[model samples]
Target: MILKTYRWSFVVTALGLVLAAWYGLSAHLGIGQAIALVLILSILEISLSFDNAVVNATILERMSDFWRKIFLSVGIIIAVFGMRLVFPIVLVSVTAGLGPIEVIRLALEGGDPETPGTYGYELHEAHPTIASFGGMFLLMLFLNFIFGEKEHHWLGPIERALEKVGKLDYVQVIVAGAVLLVVAETFATEHGRTVLASGLAGIVTYLLVNGLGELFNVEDHVEHEDPATTSAGTTASGVNGPSGAARATGKAAFFLFLYLEVLDASFSFDGVIGAFAITSDPVIIAIGLGVGAMYIRSMTVHLVEEGTLAQYPYLENGALWAIGALAVILLLSIEVEIPEVVTGLIGLAFIVASLISSIRYNRAHPEEAHVEQHHAAQPG
Candidate 1:
């Protein structure tokens, strides 16, 4: 099953390596050095985005098969080309006050990254705003998740307390707003207004997407339930079957898809900037990171299809915590430079700890394990 799921990823990896080799040969970077850099960048992307796959799986599993397919296909295109390539160019263009064509020309010229006029330099200059926006969006996601009531609690005491606090109205929003305000004042005094505005945009974007998703979801529930046969038919059509149990579809699915893409964009901000540290070559960076993204997509589908999230319930919690850590790191990084390795390792640590906890929980509660396995075994 693993091999089957990762077949396309393998193919993409091979193709990416081939492209890297060609670029290396043409650019006189040496085939081995170029291939190695691509491998390094790919590893970097995977390490930074491992938690992303887990979070994506949580939402992807709740989507219908058709939309899931769309995520892997259409979503991957947007992720690879849009986020990794065009998005950076757009950022450089907007920040440098250059046209898109001019930005493309500058990127192709590929001067020293430290030089003020270079493509890498401009992108780096835009990092504050990028970090502010992505950080706030991710913070909102983390806050919303932790603040929600859940039957399972990985970090029991802390989660319980947060859940209690979550009962208060708009607690997540208030907390996020406060954090943004502090970050703007303390860390980003020079660019305070820009940071605040970007952060607010992030908050508003999250609320809009999440609100629309919920609104459509309620409509879906209403449409699924027949007023005349609310009890029997509602269960049959909306609560019991494979398609039931909080799965997203139609307009709800579209919003979820939008959320996923934006979530992906936020996650990619760090990777895109960090890629320059390895090499300033945009083509190589794209090939390498794009290959890693393919693997992430495969991993997400594998987790969903294998019901890994269901089998290891705490995994999602761990991923969310990792996201919270990343959000903090991003916000902090606006003032202080945080290493990419630090971010990756922190997230990896959380995921590993959570996986171990999940295993211990399963061992301690075999009945619950059996029930999860039974549900997973059922056809979807």
Candidate 2:
């Protein structure tokens, strides 16, 4: 059943191409290039997003069915529009004073043929500030992934002190708000404004969307029910219930996926910019990256349904490390000269290695599925 659901993403991509080609053939746009661009970009997005799948698998695994659906639908909107479309345009508008629509138009037309300093809407004439910003941003992500604190609840003495002043929620809000303020202020400088803005924007966006989901109860209810295939009765200790540990594990996976999306955007900063070197057509870029985005979304669901994460614990570790690494690369791409293709390849290698390791681990640890089934039978 899970496999059947995922196959549709592939089908959707093929259908999109056919539709794009038909539209192109009716006009001056080259059908062949449009189709090729879509295929290439889609594949590139998918490859770049392997870590995304793994991460999402972790998160989606915990969400209720309704929330999972929302993640697929609403999450896609956020990924495509927020990251691919709105993100780049914001950078252009802030740094170059170009209108968003005009910039988008330039991207679609492949830049201005008669322009002096710019390539399409892309400013070839401006300082390499964008690249530097990307580099520095990616650097920070890498550092955080490698060295930042992992999930922690207690905080011991610190928690106690904060608890006296207010609830944990208040403290978190205060910290997050302060971070956003600092990030916003840092962007006030002329040189690294876009870079800072991008990071701040990501943080803010996550906060808003995430807050909405939380406030509106847009979370997965996997904690409440099990999928149809799994049995829902009995326990190892005759406890007549499912394991709390397994339910907790699934919940953890779901949140991990949320974090993964945030991580993917950080990686995408370079790709989105590098894509300008190829073409500026928003429609074309959208078609290409959109297709890739679709596949990643489906792949994420597959990993969870298949219990791949539980089967290969190392895959989770690998994905976390990859996200961390990509984050740093994105920061550096702001100011540095690293190629987008290089970033994609490195991320691809990490995800692929993790996947291969997972498959091998699955062969050796076949019972992993049974454990997942056992947990599934026990309800969310």
What RMSD, rounded to one decimal, does every model reach? 4.3, 8.3
lDDT of 1 by residue, 1-380 (tens): 88888998899899999988998999889899999998999999999999999988877766778888899889989999999999999988987889999999888777778998999899998998999999999999998888886657999999999989989999989999999999899878987998999999999998998777666765463224222211111110011222225566788778878888999999999999999999888888898899999899999899878877777869888999999999999999898989999999999999999999999999999998877766656555
Compose the digit string of candidate 2's lDDT tens values, residues 174-283.
Answer: 54345434433563344445545555555454555444333433224225333443433211111122223323224333443455456556555555666655665666
Off by over 4 Å in 1: 218-246
What lDDT score belongs to each candidate, Candidate 1 first? 0.84, 0.55
lDDT score, candidate 2, position 119: 34
